[model samples]
Structure formats: structure tokens, C-alpha cells
Target chain A: MSGTAPEMGRRDGSFEREPARRVFASELRECRYQFKDGEDEKSPTFVLLPTGERSNRIFIVGTLTEKTRQGEQNIFYRGRVIDPTGTFFIMAGSYQPEAMQQLAKIETPAFVAVIGKPNLYQKPDGSYLASVRVEAITVVDKDTRDLWVLDTAAHTLDRVDALATSTSPDIVKAKEQYPSVDPAVYRKMAYDALAQIKM
Target chain B: MDYSEVTERISRKFSKSGKEIDRQKVEGKLRRLIDEFGVQPSEAERSVSNELAKEFNIPAAGSSGGTGAGAGGATEQKAIAQAQPGDWVTLEGKVVSLAAPASPAIAQSGIIADESGGIRFVVWAKSNALKMKEGAWYRIESAVVDEYKNIPNLKVHSGTTITEIEKTDPLIPEPSPIRDLRPGIGSVRAKVIQEWEVTHDRMLQSGLLGDETGTVKFVIWKEPGKEKLAVGTVYSVFYAQVDEYNERLSLNITTATIMQEEGDIVTATGGDVEIRGAIVHIAPGSGIIKRCPVPGCNRALSRQNYCPIHEIQPNFVYDLRIKGWLDDGEKTHNILLKRDVVEALTGINLDQAKEIAENNPLGMDEVFLQMRDKVLGRYVACKGREIENRLLVNTCERMHFESGEHAKLLNRAGGAP
Candidate 1:
């Protein structure tokens, strides 16, 4: 957790740590739009999730179903983390050597949790692929995955509620950007994700 | 009432006045000035008269300034306690304290005292007033008193004049024990127990200072000719401003005078507090994370993917931690579980996590996932020091839970409406 105490003196434009948002993989893949609020190159780019919320960093707990190690010198460790709703694609590279090394060594079909930034890449076929740039990852159990499922469901439902009732600038931007957003669809997704968890 | 007589009276005052006075337009202007603008009917008459004279090619009366009658009256001198809110008064008092301005717009703010009592005073940056040195007497004229939280505050505006005068009778601060210091100025003689690194440039020194009574955190702001304080040396800190943040007290020594005393003090340290609560929310950057490997720098690596000071590091050290919120049915407390505590709670050590990641093709994330599954939603008792809303947990244990309660909770969670 970030320090709750306010710093005595901090300069402007200093790096602010973004909280990792709890989101199900199914809702994460629906996010296709991304934008940066500030003109500074160092500013974080946010992926506007379909649920009326923008996510720069995300956290998810799921089962590691598949893995792939591609490239030689600048190696990339790619994996798929499956939750109750859908699968989240994650990639760690040379820049994050520790995460890459950890990704290369972990076993498949095991429960795992990941905290990373979301990136959207447009394919040549005019389709968008959403993936997570893995920052930290670790092995977890079924209980942890269940807890994550409940937490993510709550967060997704909150976004759905915001979409229906709130006219906040971010929600308004999301409404304007994604016109076909049906709050009912996400509400059901959250319920389904919750149902999959065993306690 | 008809304004024709008033209009004719105004017309007769100007030389070569015409018969072109529209009684309706004059009435409308008079009504708008009186009703819409809340101007006095008498003043509205003068304004309408001036406008009518100008329209008739006559020079406007009353020096062309309508509302100059109520400007620059003699300011009434009053004691600090006698001044009420919204009163304009000239106050002559000694500056008892100089507090750090909460905002850039406020150049200076602190307590000023006369014979009656002490009252808070603020000097606006736009006021262009002379700076009041702590303990020096100042005659503040035309200051507007405003109320904040039922206390009257003297607000120095552009019209307010601040003149530094000879020193008045000094208001001596009462010496108090370290633990007895509240949100005000107090004097204390304490020995430095621990010295922490200066994080910001404005901070000259910061550390734990303890007396025979109790220990409190002390911060000395960097000022001209201020020397660094040595650890274990007893100093008499006079007029140190006490500030409470996150329910903890700290001594702010901006305008305080520090003198090394000859006596030695046996310092008393605080004991650890124990809390039992359910871990409700787990914060980010928990589980297996990387930190700057530099010997002194242990900052957690964020989006920059490197330390701000050391820059891009080749080998970042792997660390294990669990930062989460604990709810005890009343309020939530931020609790930080270190590696040892996390390992004891989750049964997954840092070495085990690293090994599990090294062995699995899915990597270190598997460990984080496993740690999350075991740690989240578990009830535990933690013992630690409360620092800035966070419990630096040193020892922790899982509270025993009944299987029946778990099953009931699960059913309630599963049967969601």
C-alpha cells in the first residue's frame, strides 16, 4: 500500500503510484480504447474499460493455463491466466527481467495472481488485442482466486453502478466513447464470475 | 412617489439645463440603482443626478466619485480578545508564533497576543505588508477580523498596514512534558534517540527525541545558520510548534530556538500495540516485488521500472510483503506484513516463491496468486507500532475460525442478490 501519510514536501510532476484495479479478465478484454490525459511523455496511458472506468494498472488472480517463451536475446515470457469469465493474456520481457525469469519457471494450470499495466494493440486485420504487461506475479491457491473473484465482482459492479447513475467526467467520457455499453451485461458478468468461486 | 420634482431639482442645479429630462428614464434609473443594486435611495438620487448632468453637457458633481463617503475612516484600536468577527480594528500585539503557511496565498499566519489573550492572524501575500518576525511587536491597522471554527482571525488585506514596533512584554511559553504537548507551541528538553534521513531539502533534520517522560518525533526545518543536531545530545527546544497528523504528534522547529543543555536524560520509548482484525483489502505491490538493490535505497520500483535516484538497475532485489487494510468492526487500520510475518501467515516464504516461479513456466506471478489466495479474507492478530495510519507489523498470527462460520459466510456470499 502507498503511505497514507502525506509527504511534507514534494515537487510537482513527481511520479504518483497508480493503484492496481481489481478487474475480471472478461471485462478487461472488452477495453479497446486508450488515451493519455497529460501531454508529458512520462504520463501514464489509461485503458478505458467498457464498465465506465479507466485502468492504467490492473490486478487479477486466476489459473495459469498456458505459457510461451519467444525471442532469444530479448526474450519474452507469455502466458494466459484464466478466471471464471475469461482468460487474460500477459507478457513479460527483458525490461522486466525478474518477472520474465519468474514467468519462464512457473508451472502451468496453477493458480496465480498478477499485477500489471494493460496495453491495447491493433492487429493488421482491424482487430484489437488486449494484453497485460506483467510487473509482478506469484503463485496462489483456490482460496486466493476465490477471494479475487469476489473482489473483482464487487469492483465491476461498482463501475456498472457508476455507469448508470454517475455523470462524473470519467464516466461521461466512457459513455461518449463506448455508446453501446449495457450496464446489465456487466452486472450479469459480475454475478457469473461470483458464482464460479467456491466460497 | 414621483421623481419629477427630484429630476427638475437636478436639472436646475446644472447651468444651461434643457427641457429634455425624461421623467420615466430618470425614474427607471433611480429604481434600478435603489432596488436591483441595493443602493440607498439618497445615493441613487445623486448617481442619477450625476448621469443626468453629464447627459446635459454639465460637469458631474461631488468630484465624480459617488461612494467615496464611507472610505478610509479612522480604525478603532482594540485588544485581541475584544475584536469580534467582521470588525475592522487596529491591533498592537507581539507575534507569539510563526506557523508555516498552509497555502501559497498566505505569506504568514500565526498567533498574535495583546494583554487580553492570543488570537490567530494571517497576512495575505497580495497585501504587500511587512513580514512580522516572531516575538516582535507590530501595529496592524485596518485588519478585517474573520471567524473560523468559532475563533476570530485577523485577516491582513491590501488596505491593512503592518508596522513593526518595539518589542512588547514577551509571552513566555510554558515548558511541558513530551507526551503532554498538544497542537500548540511548547518548550521541552529532550535527547535525540534516533536520527532519520532527511527526505526533503527543506528539512534540515528529523528524528526521534525522547525525554524522561516519553518520546516524540521532531523535525527541524532548514534555515540560515542552523546546525545539524547530534544524536544523544540533550537540547532545550523552546517554542517548538506541535503539529498533529494521522493522530500522532510531531514537533516542528521552524522558528524554535535550540540550545544544547548540560544534563543527560534516560529516554522512555513507546510500547507496541496489538490489534485483532480481519484482513479486508489487500493493497497493490504486495506478494513478490522488486526493490532498488542499492545499499541505502530500498524504494519499491514503480512504472519508471527503476529508482528515481539510482536510475535503471540491472539486478533488482526480490522482496516479499503484504500491505492490506484490517477491519476490527469499528474502523479500518492499514497494516503492513513484512516478509517474515507474511511467510508465517501465508506459509510461503520469499525463497519458496522464487523457487516456485523458477520451476513453473507461468513464473513469479503464480506465487503472488498463491499468496493472495492464502492471505486475503483471513482473520489475524497483529502486534506492531502505529506509524502514520499504518501498523508496521512485526509479529502476526491467524485467529482461529470455526468451519461452521466459514460455511455460512460462503453461502451468504454465494447466494448474492
Candidate 2:
């Protein structure tokens, strides 16, 4: 069998699936993508979205890529964390003081789990970057990594299917028609419905 | 759903597809497709699926292979050059010289040459002995690029690492020095030969002399030197500094430098003539003045005949002060009166003018009018230091009366002095 067979079995859940687990490496390389969280506070946050998110509240597992300096007193850390998909950066702020403290103690490649929003940061020089601010982190092993890859792959494929069918204006029209639909909910429903369509 | 199952599924799907797709490209395409389709997936569901597909490079069921390939290619082509911080690069160039070493510690950075091109670089006092063996090639690494005179140059900072390379090719030829060395240490020197004192405190004196490099301005000091040296006299200057100001380089002899009449006359060699055109603007208080209460105090008296300081009678003095235009047909300059020169030329005590102005409102106007003819359009030989646009001539001696015949003669001689 080709190396691609295992990837197919996991996508279809041909193998056993378990709760997502975190995988840590000596140096998890990742991009730092910035976003704002909370409506009022709108804190600048970074999210390390696992290369794939196929399950609800998908567990994003990686080690804190950046080191938090205890003496520096500043909240910015520069490091990369990795998962099965790819590597991404973790820029933790004061809101994530607990994560920061935990990160300071752990050595590079320590395992972690993050639950936060994902965002893209566009620079003036016309570059798009990806990053995450971890809401939580937990250690896990290879068994967990396998499960995450399967779940994330399924959801990602579903989104791609949804996008191929709908026109750009149809999405805009839906938003206008469903005035009461919360934007986040409407986006999810639209994508899921599109994903369900038969190719 | 377990993350391992998700990765396995993703891995299995891509493994079977026989085509590789980057997770990021898949995520972007999925997001755009969802937006285009008006399909709303729950945040959790959408995020989870997108993450899995993006991480595992799983193509959505409906995604056309052609479209995916095109998008992936476009994304890959857009990748920018990424460099980690603290990386170092090298810059090399030829040297461009400007001012000479006035003070031994002066560090001037000029041009350097490389096969690519020439760029400006500075060598410090510590690096002053960097053996710039004109034309030899040297390479400096980790030097950051900076702008000087709106031109980019390599700047060597503390973090900068430098390496010098020996000349493999022939030595680089040096450009000719801009000015000749005269009155420098161990060189023949001369003093002011003839001078014309202008109403303004400046004076211009010129004479014949010769050194290895030939005759040049020697003792052009402020307010004209106390005693002018006679012609045919040579002086020896122990130490003199050369400086470039306003693109003209000249020598400056300090008091510590030796100056004495040697009685030996040296013939002059014709050199490049230096000429400057200045604009003089006269304001309200610029004419012949009455010395107020003391020699230094320039305050005028009030109508009540009371001086600001003394409030009583004091001696008055007069001097030549100008309040008119000096036009050289090319530029117009407003000239002001130097108080001492005003006193010397007018023979009226400055203090007396203050006293008269105290009683008469038109007194200053009358005095300024009398000096206007002596100043306007008249040519004066000037030797001075320049600060910005204003020339502070140490001596301003009026050379020629303004007349058509004189103007004709000057024009005929190409305005030579």
C-alpha cells in the first residue's frame, strides 16, 4: 500500500477514534496569526488552529512554541508549536498568564492543548500569517494525535465541499434574508449545509 | 471525535487521492467555498473540519481537483522571502575624501568600491588607521545600510563584524586632492599686504607671497588685525589647520601659531580665484549710531534725553554705518553697519548720536541717508568667515568708488581683483 492509504483510513474513521490528545516536539514550528477576542475587550489574541478541525471544539494540541521570560515582565513570547498538520506560533498575552507560567517551566517541545479562535494577520508588506493564543493546554500521546488528525480532516473536507457549490452573492443574500441569524451561527449552518451536498 | 482518528482519516484520504495538498491551501479554499455557498457551519464544526482538512491536506468531497491545484499553485507562488533575525551580509566599496584632518582625531567616512558599485562608509578614530591604502579592496560584514545626504551607505555598528581583504588586483588610484597645502606647518606664510576697511566692521586685504603651493589668505581675522603687515614681508606659521567650508577649503592660523615678518618677498603663482556673492539686508537700527552710555552699550536715548542706563550726559561717538543695497548685477545684498567701523569712518561719537536722536525724531533718518551713497553699489574687498548665508567679514575695506569707468574697467578685466 502507498503512504497515502493510512491518511484515507483516518479521514473515513476506518480506524478507531479517540478523544483528541496533545503532541509536543523539541521545537514545534508554526506561524503566528493574530486576532481579536471578546466583543468589548477585543484583546489581540493568537490561535494555533490544528492543521485540521473536523470535530466540534477540536482539541488543538502542540507545545508552547515561544518561551515566556519571567524577568522580562512583558507578555509577548516568540516560539512555534507543531501538530500533525503544520507548525504555528503562540503569542500569549496577560490574559493567558496561567499558560505563560506553565510555558516558562516546560522545556522546548513540551506537549500542550489550546482552545481558542484562529485568525489571519496581514502585514503591510502583503503577507498572510497564522497564529494562536491557547485557551488551555494538556499533554497527550501518539494515540491522541491519530484521533485529532482523523476528526480535523473530516471537518476540513466538509467545509471545502460547502464552498464549491455556493456563489459569493448567495452567501451575502442569505445573510440579508436571515436578519435575525447570528453571523457565527449562520456561517456554520451555511458551510455545513454546503458540505452535505453531493459532489 | 478523537484527533488521531481525524488525522488518520485525513492522512488516509490524501494518501488515497494520489495528490498532495498543503493544509493551509485547503483551509483557505474551504473558507472561501463556505462563504460563497452561503452554507453556515457551526463555529465548532466549521473550525474542527477546517483544521482537520487544513492540517491533513484533505480535499473536500466536492472540491474540483483542477480548482485545488490552481489555488495551491497560486498560494505557493506568493510565498515571500523569509529571513530570521540577526542574519549578516557583506558590503564593499571605494573611498571618497572630503575635508582634511584639522584635529588629529577627526574621523571622516567616505566612499568605498566593490565589483558591484561604490557606497559610502565611515571609519572611526579607532579604525582611523584602517590602512585605507587607496584602491585596496576590503569587505565589511554585518554592516547595516543607512542614508547620508539622501544616499545609502553601509553603517558599521557595534554589532557589525568586519573583515579586510588584501588587494589581489592592482592598487586603486587615488583622486587628486581638492586644494593645495599652504601656510601649513613648516610652510612659508604671509600676512595681510593691503586692506580696504568698509563701514561694516569687515576688511579685505590681499598681497603677493609664495610658498611651495603659492600665496593665499593668511591672517584674515575679525575686526581687521590691529596692525597690517607691509608688502614684501614673509611670516612663518608654526601650525595651521586646513578646513572646508561652503565647498571652499582654506587654512586657519590660530594665535598659538608663529607669525613674524621675514622681510623676504616671494613671487605669487596664479591659482584658482575664489569669489563669493552675498546678499545684505538692512533693518531699522542699521545706520551711523551714537554710542549710548558706554562703548559696548548700543541703547539709544528716549525723547526725555535720559539714557536707559546712565539717565545723564555722557560722551558721544560716531562711526561709519551703512543702510543700503549692494547689487553685483547678479544678486542683491542688504549691508549693515559695524558700529566700530561706523565710528571710524563718520568721526561722530556714537553716544552723541544717541543724545541727538533722543531730542529729534528724524535724527537717525538723516544720519542713515548721508552714509547711503558711500555704501550702495560700491565694491569692497572682503575676507571673512561665513555662517550660513551671512558672511561675517573680519575686514571690509571699500576698494573702488562706484562709477561707469570703474565698472567698465572691472567688466573688461573679467571682474579680477
TM-scores of the models, in the order given: 0.49, 0.25
DockQ, each predicted model: 0.04, 0.00
Q: What share of the true interface contacts does each candidate keep?
A: 0.00, 0.00
Q: Over the stretch B305-337, how does candidate 2's per-residue lDDT look in tens digits?
A: 456666654565444354322323223333344
- Compare the candidates by lDDT and give the number of the best one: 1
The fnat score for candidate 2 comes to 0.00
User: Model 1 over residues B334-353: C-alpha lDDT tens digits?
Assistant: 77888899999888888898
> Can you tell me which runs of candidate 1 are displaced by over 4 Å?
A1-15, B1-250, B253-417
Instruction: Show where candidate 2 strays beyond 4 Å.
Output: A1-199, B1-179, B182-188, B192-233, B255-261, B266-285, B290-318, B328-355, B363-366, B373-417
